[model samples]
Target: MSTAAEIADHKSSVRERVWTELRKVAVADSRFHFDFGEFIADFEGGEEAVHRLIDHSFYRDAELIFITPDNCLDRLRLRALQDGKVVLMTTYSIKRGFWLLDPAKIAPDHYLYASTLDGMERVGQHLTLAEIQATLPNVDYMVTGTGAINHEGVRFGKGHGFFDSEWGMLYQIGRISVATPCAAVVHDCQVLVEKLTPDVYDTVVDIIFTPTRTIEVHNPHKPTCGIIWDRLDQHMFDTIPPLQELKAMGL
Candidate 1:
């Protein structure tokens, strides 16, 4: 089967599994009655645990990378900056809403912003989520979150595919290099023991950071460039003029 087919199958399978799990959990825990704050707190106390995890991980020198709009991990970017580490984060948009968390205080030079295809320039280099969304540009590394993309009976992402698309863009631009260390911050629940069937455009994280552990994927896979224009329908790609531009830049 083609890589695209494999990816699609994986996503479908994971979605089913995740929905099943979510439903089960919801049925068991009434507190998760669609309350975002309660859900985040009950799952892990959100930022508090995340802060502890960062301290336990000793991120002073590490290039701190995080998934956008994830309030939990995004807070750690601030701690990383306070400790004088390079932090890169993803943002949704500058005009749409306020950042769930912002890292502008640290001011690192290596911000990598993911640009919207519409030419919404990502704001900062070594940019956080909004930083990437506001300022369309290039950078060195990509931070992919665990469960961001899944294939064939596998599940990924809480519900968003921003990480996968961003990684795809970096790969298309030939920005992801051997030295580029891509990492992800995920909760323990997000990790799966089964081997995930990966597909083209699906980027595997080089490092996975959980509250208790920092994992490294020994052999990493890069994403496929040139967005299969017809196959692109994910809500995350809406208004992504930069996506096509990024793809064309690859060829």
Candidate 2:
């Protein structure tokens, strides 16, 4: 068995290669809007693959869902709004923090726009960590975009760790229990047949949805504990709203 450091190194190597190939496509693709790193959405047919994710049974049964603010997921969010599901979205880069989106709270005709980040800012109510603690309901399902994932449940998401942090916050606040299933929407090529182990505090996905099919991870592993503050720097607390709120709360 490889050591933790070795596993991490291997994971990084895989991400680098995969991202390089995807980035080449992203730069050449005319519709690509990515300015940062190689995002999964930049790949051909990336956002279009969300159609299969919306039709998954997990998504259909979820009443309250938490999803990323990635533009690639806009269609899924629009469908979620039309389905009358409560959607939760985070600010750009998870910096300003979370917002609660209710279709009932929005105009009937604006449901489509509400799914976009600009529309989310226009209408969604920003929730502080304390506010979320006070009034947030149990999340039935969680969804996010993944750059890559394997059958072992390990995932990589632009190497920023926002998705894991979001999951950690929900888990720590008691909004999402251990049983709450988390899914990552990805293109079929992003699913790896090889194994990639999760690093400590990394949130593993329970399901992977592709345009072709759903891949179930039978042994999904989530964070054993809540946020690993030791892994974070003080600068992070100053930047991320949730961390700042946690500090203000004397946590």
Candidate 3:
């Protein structure tokens, strides 16, 4: 078994290699300059990948979807709204907690704008953890953008635990479950052939959609433990309001 340090080091190396290759191909988002922190969004075939996801059965069947705030997923968010699917997403880094985007409430003209992080605040309603538990229905599906991922379903996310925390909070509130199908959308270059070790808190994906293909895992690792508090420090607890709120409410 690989030690924690070894696992982290391997992930770092993979991230660096993938990020470098992505830049070489000019797939990296230009807005962020050279350093594509937390992986590059708007990569080559990104729109095509989103289109593929929209065509998938899971996406078609889902009424409510939890998508991350990664810039690459902006198109997915927009499509979800245009399709009238309820979107539950976190602010960048979950710094501001969860926002619920209801297509019915947003104007058709704003669909394009509302899909963005900045635009979400304008059209989406912010919800507290308690409010989320009281009102939101079970999330039908979940999708996120990744720094790098392997065929085995292991994911690395800009060294931040935002996605895991988001999953943990939702799982703790019974908003999502073990049966919820999770997926990752990325560029073909982001998919690694080498083995990647998953930490206990890592959330493995059931499906991977790239611009060119869809790869499904035989048996993805799903972490049942919600919110590994021991692994979180005071800084995280203090910075992420949702975490503090969840802990305070004893959720």
Candidate 4:
């Protein structure tokens, strides 16, 4: 069995390898440099992948979705709004908490602009954890962009725990459950054949959608514990307001 340190080291090596490959073929993001801080690169055929996700029954059936603010997911967010699906998205690192984007409230002309991070703040309603618990419906599906993922469903992103924290917080608040399916959208090169181990708090996705195909993991491991408070550091508590809010609320 690999120790935690060994697994982390392996994951790091995998990320370096994948990121290098991604830059070689990634579509340029005008707002960010490809090598920018933990940016999930938009890959070749990425728009096609989003279209594939839109066609999936999980996405088609979902009335509400919790999507991360990864660069690769901008199109998905836009499509969700155009389809009249409610979108719950967090700010960069969840520093500013969550934003709820209701299609009905947005002007049809702004759907394209509303999908971008800057546009979301202008058009989407911001929500606190308490507000989310009191108002929003349970999330029907979850989608995120990943740095690297394997056939077994294990994934990590640019060494940041943002997605894990998002998942943990939502799970704690009863917005999502073990039965709620999650999907990871990535470039084909980001999918690994080598086995990757997951930490206790790491999220395992039920499905992996690449530009070329969708691969489902049989009986994927999903974390039941919401937030592992003890593992969090003072930096996280200081940087992310939602964490502080949750802590103060004794959640």
CA lDDT scores, all candidates in order: 0.45, 0.77, 0.87, 0.87
lDDT of 3 by residue, 188-230 (tens): 8889998777777789999999989999987888888888888
Model 2 residue runs over 4 Å out of place are 1-8, 24-43, 46-48
Q: How do the residues 169-203 of candidate 1 rate in per-residue lDDT, one tens digit apiece?
A: 54455444445555555555555666676556555
What digit string (tens of lDDT, one per residue) describes model 2 on residues 19-85? 6655554434233455334344634565556766777788888999998876567788888988899
Error at 101, model 4, angstroms:
0.6
Query: RMSD in angstroms, all models?
Result: 7.7, 2.7, 1.5, 1.3
The numbered model that scores best in TM-score is: 4
TM-score of 2: 0.88
Query: How many backbone clashes are present in model 3?
Result: 0
RMSD in angstroms, candidate 2?
2.7
What ordering of candidates by TM-score runs from best to worst? 4, 3, 2, 1
lDDT score, candidate 1, position 2: 52
What is the clash count for each candidate, in the order shown? 32, 0, 0, 0
- Model 4 gets an lDDT of 0.87
Better of 1 and 3 by lDDT: 3
In model 2, residue pairs whose N, Cα or C atoms come closer than 3 Å (at least 3 residues apart or on different chains), thus clashing, are none
Candidate 3 residue runs with Cα over 4 Å from true position: 26-31, 38-40
| Candidate with better TM-score, 1 vs 2 | 2
